[model samples]
Target: MILHLPAQKIPIQEIPIDKKVKLFIKREDLIHPEISGNKYWKLFFNINTYLAGNPEKPYIITFGGAFSNHIAAVSAVGNLAGISTLGMIRGEELKGKWRENPTLVFARRNGMNLQFVNREEYRHKEKLTEFLQSEFPDALIVPEGGTNKEAVEGIKMMLNDETKDFDYLCTAVGTGGTISGISEFCEENQKVIGFKAVMDNSLEETINKLTSKRNFSLIDSSFGGYGKIKDENIRFINDFKMNYGIPLEPIYTGKMMQKVFGMIEEGYFPENSKVLCFHTGGLQGIEGANLLLEKQNRNLII
Candidate 1:
């Protein structure tokens, strides 16, 4: 069963930070229930292509962190498609307490076989074939973040028939797969700016090796690091809701928008430059963020 979701071109709204500047959002967040945002497109075509070519392969295995949306999405979609899925999760054993992590809970409920691996082995996920061969020995291995060449090609379909005349195209960078794919499809005159959610130099090298586009630049705008948010980011999250009536989670889209606003204030973006921001969905994180906000409110009350 192929899931279909219409791409929404969210209206360009003028920023209160700068009245002269306009920001447009490509709402990939509203894509689908299981296949949300670019995650759907990234994994969908790759899985379909693999299955079609190799009908003998009955199971697919992938790797991710405990709270990874990719794992959750893959588990749900794979179950629906009648494919047995395995999730190699990074961390110590949490056999009985997996429900504490929402993504892990969902993945388990969707029939994903979970295996725990330490951080040391998880870092060497690129050589997953050896690990899987020693372990499952039969399942097809998918790279962490679903960032293979097939995944990049699948994500490129999201830009089909859209106007590519924008000055800047911005996206939240997780594994640099989506940005690298977008960079490949963008025109030479267009600039692709990626907001790195994690503080690391390796991601830049990864993207550089993936695409040969000189117009692409990855910014280290991570508010501290991956899954880490400061007070300033919380304020930006609040202001984003107030100004645009759109709620951005701190982990992904919030940081992207925060950096975009900061660049606008710093006068880094050229005047009257059309900016297109991609909203990579992570709505599951909202529960944790809201709980933190409530704790802060209670502290102020006390």
Candidate 2:
């Protein structure tokens, strides 16, 4: 079975902003309904490259937190490629009751084996790799968030002739693979701006490790941190959907868009400067995030 092709570039469109910075969203979100956006790019090469040269058929095993978009994407790819998928989930509390976790439930339905680990145990990747190698000897281990060299290769194609005219390349930074990939393909004059979806002081160096180019800068737009949201962000997301008809998940695209609008308002960009915003989809997590928001009596995303 063939995995969907990379470089599924969506039509570019301009959004009217007060500063007239010419902000255009390159809709990577529309690449696929389930395995949408950057996740698709991140997993594309990892699966293909591994399957190409391996003599022994192997199950795919990867890591992710409870609400991980990576887990869902890998599961879908495994189903498409006729490979068995195993997810080493972060929270041990979610072991048997996978159905209670929306993302895990979807993963299970897609035919992924669920293995839960405590937060402490999850931190040690080397140990996790050793353990998996011993148990699932035939497992092709895809790194957390699939940010390996092969994954970056697929992501580089996200920018091509159609997206070459933009002055800046922008996307939400997760494991830094997407932005890293984009930076490598960007022109010298084109600046790559990555807005962090999670707040971590160590992220700048983390992103640097994966990419050789120094043309990119990482900004903290993480509301508070990953999964944390402000009321204004929620309001902006709802209004954006009403105005543009493009939905954004609270975790990633929402925070990045909020930062972009703020930059425009503050004149961070020069007048008439063109910006390309990568719509890396995490819309699936909205349903689960909204559930938590409702229980906390916080303002919900539309």
Best by lDDT: 2
Query: Candidate 2: what lDDT?
Result: 0.85
lDDT of each residue in 208-241, candidate 2, tens digit only:
8878899998889888778777888899899899
RMSD of each: 3.1, 1.6
In the range 261-298, model 1's lDDT, one tens digit per residue, is 88887888877888888877776666655655576662
Model 2: clashing residue pairs? Answer: none
TM-score, candidate 1, is 0.89
Give the residue spans of candidate 1 off by over 4 A: 1-18, 133-138, 288-302
Q: Whole-model lDDT for model 1 versus the true structure?
A: 0.77
Score residue 254 of candidate 1 by CA lDDT.
Answer: 91
